[model samples]
Target: MTIAPQRVVTLHYVLNDEQGAVLDDSRARSAPLEYLHGHDNIMAGLERALEGRQEGAELTVTLAPGDAYGLRNEALVQEVSRAAFPMADLTPGMRFQTPGDDGPQIVTILDVHGETVRIDTNHPLAGRTLHYRLEVLSVREANRAELVKGHPLSADVAASQVEDRKVP
Candidate 1:
C-alpha cells in the first residue's frame, strides 16, 4: 500500500551529512525505523519524499538545513548562572536534555566561566544539510491504538503494558 496518513511505515535508512560522513545507519543497528505517516514522527522533508512510496521502494533524498533541523538560532545561545546546574564539573561540549518552552530540548555547553555557563539550545544537526538513502521494508494500515498514539507501537507490547508505557 502507498504511504499515507494512518499508515505505519517500516524502513531502513543511511543518513549522511553534507561532508558525506555517515551520521546514522539503521541497518548497522539491526533495527528498522517505524513511524506513523503524516504524524510528524520523522523529518518533514523525508516524510514528503516517502508520501507515495510502497513497500520495497528505495529512494535517496537530500534536505537543506531549513527542511531538516532548521537554521541555528543565535538567540538560543545564552549564559545562565553556573549554580543552575547541579553538576559541579561543568565542561564544554557536554549535552543535557532539559525542559524547554515547547518540550524537551538539548542544551550543549559552549563554555563554563567562574559563575556562568554558556549553552546552546539549537539541535546538534541544526544548520547542516542532510542526505538520506531509504529502503521501505513494509507499509501497513495503523491500528486504532497506533493511530491514537500518533506513532507505531511495538507488536510485543501487551495492552496493559501499553497503557503504562511512557515515552521519554
Candidate 2:
C-alpha cells in the first residue's frame, strides 16, 4: 500500500544543507524514525514527497527554502536586553526559548553586544536548501494509540490499544 495521510510510516533519512554538510541523519541511530503522515510530525515538503510512496522505497528530495523552513526574515532578528535571559550565559550560537506573540519560540543568539543580545527567531535551517536521502522501511494503518499521540505507536502503546479493544 502507498503512504498516505494518517498512515504510519517508518523511514531512515539523512538531511544535509546546501553545502552538503550533514544536519541530521536517522541512519546513525538504532531505529528508523516513525511518524504519522500529514500530521506535521515532519516537514510538510518531506511529507508531501512521501505521499503515494510504498514501503522500502528509497528517494532523494531537495526542498527549497520556502518549501522547507522558509526564508529567513530580517524582521525576526532583534536585539534584546541581556537581562531577559537570566539563566543563560548568552553567547553566539546559543539557542534560547522566548515568549512571542504566537507563543514560545526558540531563538539563536547571532551576536552579543555588551548589554544587548542579538537573537534570530528564524529556524536554524531557514533560508537554506535542504537535501534529504530517505528510505521508507514500513507503512501501515495508524493504530488508535498512534492517532491519539499524533505519532507512531510504541510497542507498549500498541499492546494497550489491543487490550483496550478486547471484549470485557
**CA-lDDT, candidates in order:** 0.93, 0.89
- Compared with the true structure, model 1 gives a TM-score of 0.91
Q: How many backbone clashes does candidate 2 have?
A: 0
Please estimate how well model 2 matches the true structure, expressed as its whole-model Cα lDDT.
0.89
Task: Report the C-alpha lDDT of model 1 over 1-168, residue by residue, as the tens digit.
Answer: 999989999999999999999999999999999999999999989999999999999999999999999999999999999989999898999999999898888999999989989999999999999999999999999887787778888886536456666575
C-alpha positional error of residue 82 in candidate 2 after TM-score superposition, expressed in Å:
1.3
True-vs-predicted CA distance for residue 68, candidate 1, Å: 0.7
What digit string (tens of lDDT, one per residue) describes model 2 on residues 9-123?
9999999988999999887876789989978988899999999999989999999999998998999999989897886577789887778887777899999888998889997
What is the Cα-based lDDT of residue 2 in candidate 2?
Answer: 92
